[model samples]
Target: ALVYVVAGAGVLAGSGWWPTAALVAAAGGLALKAIWFDPWLSVGVLLDVGVIVAVACTWPASVY
Candidate 1:
């Protein structure tokens, strides 16, 4: 759901993806509002960003 998409965006962004990441994040929000019945919470965009930053900094550069 939203968490997944946000995480995916952050991961992708950390891997050098930009607009796609934004799209993913937006999509996550949209999915949360549209698909899921629980629309009271905002997607954890910051959490995903933090995850991306951490992974990017800790991991070595490699194409996988």
Candidate 2:
């Protein structure tokens, strides 16, 4: 959860490490949801996918 906060802040701040941090956080969140298997977590799955796609699309040629 803290990673998500850090990654989100990084993304907003245009930090060089945001893409990696975001992807890692998204993957970790998705894995956690999968292992827990709660119906309410479906939204989080979609959010994870959104984060992945967003990162892929927005990544720049040079982060810094």
Instruction: Write the residue-wise lDDT of candidate 1 on 1-64 in tens digits.
Output: 5555654666665555543454555556555556664534444544445545645564434522
lDDT (CA) for every model shown? 0.52, 0.85
Report the number of the highest-TM-score candidate: 2
RMSD of each: 7.3, 2.9
Off by over 4 Å in 2: 59-64
Per-residue lDDT over 1-64 for candidate 2, one digit per residue giving the tens place of the 0 to 100 score:
8888998798678777978888899999999999998999999999999989878888455543
TM-score of each predicted structure versus truth: 0.31, 0.81
Worst 10 residues of 2 by lDDT: 55-64
| Deviating ranges (above 4 Å) for candidate 1 | 1-16, 36-64
Best by lDDT: 2
